[model samples]
Target: MGLFEDLSRFLETRLDEFLKANPHLELWGLEDQLRGQEQDAIRLLGDLKRREKQLEDSILATAQDIQRWHSRIQQAQAANRIDLVKAAQEREATLLRQGNQYWGQLKGVKDQIMQTRTLQKDIHDRRRELKAKIAETQAQRTAQRTTTSWDTGWAKTSFDGFGRDPMDPLEESFQRWETEQELEELKRTMGK
Candidate 1:
């Protein structure tokens, strides 16, 4: 059909062949790899969260420092200390710049956290899908085998004790005698 469908079919065929050849081991290995990827993504998300918190703390501290400097500048101006006011203003400006940088970095870290989470989710979904596919394929193979065996009646049929003629003369005579004895017994019971 379409190119994507063709590619998908090709990949699925190869995957089936690989699975048939290695079965549980290959599937387990792939699942383990996906799990490892998920773990790594989670760890990275943790690190990003930690960095975001640190950045937030740094920004808060900077804001506090800026407020304190503003109050000091007011006090300096009230006391007519222009020199101290100017110095405080410069310090406040620097803190503001540093705070902005931290904010930018925090945003970047948050974006990375989102990306890592998405990657983890994808890995988890892929792992689940692969497991389902493996199980379905295994079940189909088992059912196919069962149908084949049952259709052939391998277990229900046997050639044991068979001969050219299944009914020998003496065996036929014996069967007839047994039938007659059963009939006589049934008749006697009815009479009683």
Candidate 2:
């Protein structure tokens, strides 16, 4: 068990380092976790509903038995049979206690279902937020076309790789302006 714990801790440390290095992948990881939580909450909600139904049935059965015994107690009273009346009253009280226990269990299951539903809703919201962040990350990566030196295309217009004019003045002006815009965008992203 000690060795297994060591291995688990080692793996968790490695995973954390990996996520820190690739921050964009962290969004995907969080979304995946939320999806699993959503599924788990849904499954648990189903189980709780089934249990609630069973408890309701038990309470109903016990209530009916309690009522039947109550009738017997009244009948014994009218017949002046004190012994039977006493026994029927005891049986009715026992059934009432059982019914109350079932009611308590039913209330607990209902509370769990409510909590699980809230958890499911929270996970769903987190997933939506993470998906939006992932989409923004993908768009940012796509927009960052140049990896070096901020892409000053003015030099390119004056001299191509072979020291010849690459394009006319009109085109050169447009390319230089476009390159500056891209550089500014990259700077803003880096600041964040």
Candidate 3:
């Protein structure tokens, strides 16, 4: 390889090693973002539930008012008081209109609550998937580190009961020669 290509490879290897030694550095921002999203989902769900309850209560009270006015109109008609009956009928009509409006609003609020709940569930599921992916990545990294350490341990062990150094000089020299030969072969193949 050219000098610049070799330098690039060296830099990349060093960066990988640095990052492997500091696993938390890469995950910090992503973890924080996930936490924030989870919190926002929880807050939104709570707000939607509260609003749904309020709308339901308001709809119930309006329905009760409409019923009360209807009974008053009936009582006035039974007493044969035309003036009182007419006033009660008018009041009942107004209350009926208000009740219909409140019912429509309640339906709209219920739809919104259902939508919000669905969104919350989606966010919750995504957060769980993200957490699982992060855990899987961590487990893979740990396995890779363990394999590397196992290889290093083998390097330190004696081969065939020989009290030689961790790295055999002859093997190192042969490896270097092989690497140079491979590079030369690559260069020749590329017509460099």
Query: Across residues 42-74, which tens digit of lDDT does each residue of candidate 3 receive?
Result: 787688678778867877887788789889888
lDDT of 2 by residue, 1-192 (tens): 999999999999999999898778998888888899899999999999999999999998998999899999999999999999999999998899889999999999999999999999998988998999999987876556432213543333256676656554556677899999999999999999
User: Which is the winner by lDDT between candidate 2 and candidate 3?
Assistant: 2
Candidate with best lDDT: 2
Collision pairs in model 2: none
> Cα miss at 153, model 2 (Å)?
11
Q: What is the Cα-based TM-score of model 3? A: 0.57
Q: Residue 93 of candidate 2: its Cα lDDT? A: 88
Ranking by TM-score: 2, 1, 3
Cα-based lDDT for every prediction: 0.84, 0.86, 0.76
Among these predictions, the greatest TM-score belongs to 2
Of 1 and 3, the candidate ahead on lDDT is 1
Worst 10 residues of 1 by lDDT: 156-165
Pairs of colliding residues, candidate 3: none
Model 3 CA deviation exceeding 4 Å by range: 1-28, 145-192
Candidate 1 vs 2: which has more TM-score: 2
